[model samples]
Target: MTANPTATEPTLLSLPAPDEWPHWMGARGDAQLAEARRLVDDLKAQRPSEARQVLRVWNDAQTALSNAASIASLFSEVHPDRDVRERAENLMQDVQKLDTDLGLDTELFAVFADLDDTDLDADASRVLEHTLRDFRRSGVDRDEATRARLRELSEQAILLSQEFSKNIREDVRSIRVRPEQLAGMPQDWVEAHPVDEEGLVTVTTDYPDVIPFRTFAHDADARRELVTQFLTIAWPANDAVLQKLFAVRREHASLLGYATWADYDAEVKMIGAGQAIGEFIDRITALSGERAERDKAVLLERLQQDRPDATDIDGADATYYAELVRKEQHAVDAQRVRTYFPFEAVRQGLLDVTGRLFGLEWTPVSQEAAGTWHADVATYDVARDGERIGRIHLDLHPRDGKYKHAAQFDLVRGVRGVQLPEGVLVCNFNRGLMEHDEVVTLFHEFGHLVHHVVGGDQEWVRFSGVATEWDFVEAPSQMLEEWAWDADVLATFARNEAGETIPADLVAAMREADDFGKGYDARTQMFYAALSYDFHVHETPDLTERLRELMGRYSVFPYIAGTHMQCHFGHLDGYSSAYYTYMWSLVIAKDMFSAFDRNDLFDPEVARAYRDKVLAQGGRRDAADLVADFLGRPYTFDAYAAWLAE
Candidate 1:
């Protein structure tokens, strides 16, 4: 690894107390931004012969800036204290402005252009190439006035994104229900929400409250009411925010000589173009067409058993019927499955599974060493061969004002010998027992955690961790989800309070039941992919209307009026027009998993090979090359297609 030349050792990242956040974050961020500017000035004055050294210095400075920004941004999403979260959000905007300014620095671009690419090693060459490309994409080559406008637009984009997410996070709508409305839900779930003085129970749109209610609640009106609230999250307010966001992005793309925001966004991804995303979405939809129809038929038929006069079902009814089908036909009750998976057990089991597969050890980190914003957060140090590799934090339960989804956020990028990688997995699940689907999510996010740790050993920070193509980032995590389904893997950790492992037959039933929803699930994802794509590709005035159109085209369920799903579609902010990346990456994941022997998922030799060939390469190689190296061939869609058909 190349030394930073400016520092002997980089400071490890940690969350400051809420009271100290504003000061610590403000001072650290200011210093890092100033240092980055100073390095750019140094690079501009350096002789061509010193290009390599000066570039390394520049990278070191930017790395520091990135770490500060990332840590603050992560806390902004997951911190329990609202004021602290807001402060962190403001800090994140400052970092985004600095990043935009750096990207648009023509002098820095000129300095890089003067360097000879042949002088650098393979990894460094890739870094230089990507940097130059990014500069061009950032409009560094434009006139001064245009560059200034780009800077303004970039900052606006950041603010708008923050607003969109904040609206969703803050809006937690609820409904009151009678005790009879809780029928069919688990006894524990029912007990958790005791009747109030009015002889009513309150259910909120939080995942823990809403998911089971939608799946198991017998009262159709109660389920539909809750679904309406869930789907309309951040409705009228985000309506305007989203429109402004779209306009700003459209103008940003227009200024950069692209037809649409989607076109501009797709340039850096593996898919290469917006039109190609449409094609991919169409292809997947076709692949799932037969299965989706069959599944929809079964669901519609099941609906008729209760409502014989009903001709169709809405999104609210889909989950209930699907669970009913799983219980009746496949003999797997989701509520019963939750009994085996206690939250704490699943956490340890995940650590054990990954550690055994990758030949690593994990030990708890003291609170003193790993400062946290919340007590619910847990910290660990990951080690391989008795050497500390990275630090990871798990913030894995629901709370008011927390991010409403599960994801892994990188707190620090690991550049070997310079700093240790740090990541936090933020999730919302019940604190006691977890739903089986929640277990899958945990494994999936942990896959990303493992990727960040294993891939952080690269010499250049730019190529470190999950810094690969934006489109390929989800593949490793998606691939890791397979472990959640394997009977042997489940037996290791899934247990009841009575100390009994989950029955193998029950797992088989769960597997069989899982097949029942494939068609509808695939179509649902296609709807999301299409919605994400069309919103950027087509400049429609009515996002709601366009969303409805896409829903009809891609989803099996008809659009439910009065639900503005786009308001709470958070990916429209972060992922922008690249939501198709999920499906694209899944294709690669399935193909790669084909290399593993299903009967022996714990094969050390195969696991080690995957670790070295895929995760360790990081962004040093193209994603295609990385996969080919591990599989001895390029990935194909056959695996995904077969899975969808099954």
Candidate 2:
């Protein structure tokens, strides 16, 4: 029963209170923080005979605290106001410390500690099991001295992560280029970038600018300069932060009796050990090296033919040369393809595909009073058979102080009778039409929004949302990327401003061209995953060697001298040792797609099974089980291997 229950539907709950941005965030955060504390106190004060009731209160408090922290932290990451960001950061610190305190609270742990695990249902049992696990992990079972030290380490680790992200967010580096340097770029993009007083155009490292300049700019020196600015983003400042952050993680993991941070994180993921992750990376290296080298030689041949002065290519030369090779050899120019897939069309295509497959509809609603942080933000009501399933927010453009990457933020996670699930998909793409790959990226991120909000709707916050083991979290979204390649789906959304649909022949041509550079892309990710893994295994991260070594082995091109990619590699901030998850999740994603392809690409039966079993289930069950249930078979790497072979 909601506070404002209607006769028609109880689940059609009231909108969020205070109901607007800025004010609502702080007020809601503070109020929820208070309520959560009250709830926790109530739980601790309860008698052991009232275990069920106490557990209920604990669950409520868990959700409340989560909501409070989310509101505060969202602003800290995406708010344009620095003052709001600073205050939100402090608020997050306070909330996190409170969380640590509660997790370590002996009385809090004792509330449901003695309950017979067999007495509860599967969901409740899992929730209780997780609750106690978190408590134990927080040093609830340790002595007072050890508990204090653990708290200190938790604070330090979190604060360091916050700082690391802050640096990247504040990194507003840009390169000014002459109009001559931007020849062959898309028209809409060229028009968007107005020249300054000196007649030079400013190109930020935003994907919209960097990707275009690298993919279209014929000038090697210009692309090289832009790549340099991009590679060194927030350097020296971020460099020192990353170094200390490594030591803190090592200490934090060591205190937990783990040899490395990789070990600690792996304890909860689908893959069991740090060694297993390494072996996975090594397996990919073995499978991909020959193909990646062949692709590199092709690019090297182009480089030598075009720029006789260059014996080999560098990181700067990779994108530009690859684009050149793509055009000359495959008759596929990414910029040319972008003309067909505008942002609106691509977005509509995603909506269309989801509507068909999931038996759903999306209606645009004014979220103005909802206090959208930006004018570009749009809210949509997601419905199935005219009953609202949930809401989704799309913040699809780049702006200052926004999270500088493409991701889905589960702003409000679904919990039966408490609150509705809402998510925002944030990405930095051209305000105009996107390249084929950019469309794929959008579909991928939105896939996350759906997975986060719809897939994980359990009553308990701890049991809800995309809590799947980290390595498997990307699978659903990765599966969505396959939709981008489907000719039927592409025809639906791949339209120009004139409303001419993309030709089927072109789609086939583009698909063929797509695989030409995929080997290099795989190798690049392997480099990143390997580098991230090494950062954790050592006492101190010799990022210099790791970058050089991995770049040599996994990169399709040679590295540039005096340039450090790690300084700007924000993966070090949060992903840390888990960068391998991209490839890991990709394998599962490909497997899931293969199952879908075996039926129809837009098969309603497949979509329903996926939603009920995989997406909607969230982390309620093991990811492997969810996948198996959907596929009607056990998991295998065969689909991924087959895709790579093609």
Candidate 3:
């Protein structure tokens, strides 16, 4: 790929340089909004006889706005320059408001309302159906005052959500400890954090530092200190932010005839309503309870070795003690296992694994050619049978202002004969050696990237790239994590500096050790899921009390007083009332994985069938239909049940 570009070309594909972001964002954003509004006016004046013609214009306008919005949104999270990031954040709110305004346009809604959906293809019909539903949800039929109020609330919600995330992203808390406090930490990790002139190591709550610290460091007090700081991220700042957000959302939902935000949020998801969310949490909790207790007992037993009077394991000690059990009982030494996985190797291995499975190839694209925001970001062109299909960018390290967690963000939606899709994977992992869990996380996020690329080649932008129901979006990614656990899979890519592949027995032990934490993990997810659901369903929300009640009810660890876990829970803003999606998606993921032959991780027949049936379907079919198309039956909780029981 060439880096050179004609300076006069639009800056959308090749993102503007940091200094040019504000000007480019403002100019391009206005162009998109003005064009969309003009298109809506044109459509109102001259209704096309053919519905497809109307839809084509509708899709194009929406797509233009979406592309601009996606860029602004992504840059807000990953841009290193604060001024650029701030500009992006503000632009995103404006773009969101403009989009919401378009959705509420009565005249525009009527144009779609009158479209004859008969004799249309699946993708076109699906797009029409969703558009009509969305318009109603946007209050298109409401009175002028009501519509104006909805718009106001929508803008408020977007701004508040941004503030919530911004608070967490900017607030990087840390604790200092002596070298002795890092006794059980990986040597590489300890070396990476050199002692300052004060002779103390600084550990921040960034994922690269905090996760390993919690999982390995021996000093309980230090672990407690770090964990407490980690949990308190964006605390009091987010408290008010969350309060205003909930108020805005509550009013918005009420105006829309929804009883609560939870009800409104779940209407379009696989999970139907707030009540069902509670049932789901309860059902999963029951399934994992017995095993969770056994795990707690084992962890507490390990804890008592250090403190004879220790009664229970707290959040700070959970991962530390769990590692002790894994090494002693399952022969899975996490620190030893990490030696085989460096970030670069894991990165290439990930491409190789997915490429083999999907009959695709990935070729590196230079940063300049890709017009990336940072040097650390790497780009790849995806192809099948020599025909380029899509592209992906990987941003895999921690920085002061970067997003604190891993996720896949869509930069472009591949509309066949229009534009090819592009997705970005933003994560935080150690640059050299990586934890096994980090490897799995890498695989998981890439799964979303793969879905976006493979599923993207759709006739309409609406049906392109991981556009499935929100709750089902994580299944493909979660299922891909299974590959990371396979011994053969690990042997292919996980080699140490000495070039020794991980032993099959070691992978086996790792898998067994992995099973040990499932119950606790599942229960912890339940706690978050409960908190997510509880916060939205009620008329009045006491954020702290709700967080405390849910944590105590479902978590293996007791809630630390004065700590506001919800403040740091970024999903509360993104997923809103549906953080249960992770668990819900995992149930589907486990079920989907059962179709694979365990011995052949790269079975072409199974791989191709899945790629065509599931990934290629995108949002054209219902998620359940897509799952059934591959599995030859509706997905069930059986596989998930069996997994939890393991």
Tens digit per residue, CA lDDT, model 3, 39-107: 777788887757888888887777777777887888899989888788778878878888898888898
- By the TM-score metric, which is better: model 1 or model 3? 1
The total number of steric clashes, by the backbone 3 Å criterion, in model 3 comes to 0
Q: Which candidate wins on TM-score?
A: 1
**Estimated TM-score per prediction?**
0.98, 0.95, 0.97
TM-score of 3: 0.97
TM-score winner, 1 or 2 = 1
Which lDDT values do the candidates have, in the order given?
0.88, 0.78, 0.88
TM-score comparison, 2 vs 3, better candidate: 3
Better of 1 and 2 by lDDT: 1
Error (Å) of candidate 1 at residue 558 is 0.5
Compared to the true structure, candidate 2 yields what TM-score? Answer: 0.95
- lDDT score for residue 615 of model 3: 96
Candidate 1 worst ten-residue window by lDDT: 1-10
Error of 1 at 411 (Å): 0.9
- Itemize residue pairs with steric clashes in candidate 2: 21-371, 342-433, 455-615, 455-616
Which tens-of-lDDT digit does each residue in 1-646 have in candidate 2? 0111212322322234322444655676788788888877766665455444556777777777877777666768776667677767877887888998997888877776877666677877888887787887677878888778878877887788788888788887788889988888888888999999999999888777888788888777888888888887777777787888888778777777788889887878898898888899989888787888888888888999977777777778887788888788888777768889878877877898977877778888875445466678788878777877677878888888877888887677767666667777878876777888788898899888878767645766776778788889899899888888888888877887788888877888888888887777888889899888988887545666667877887776777776778887878876889999999999898888876753268877777888788988877888899989989888898988888888
Candidate 1 lDDT score at position 333: 89
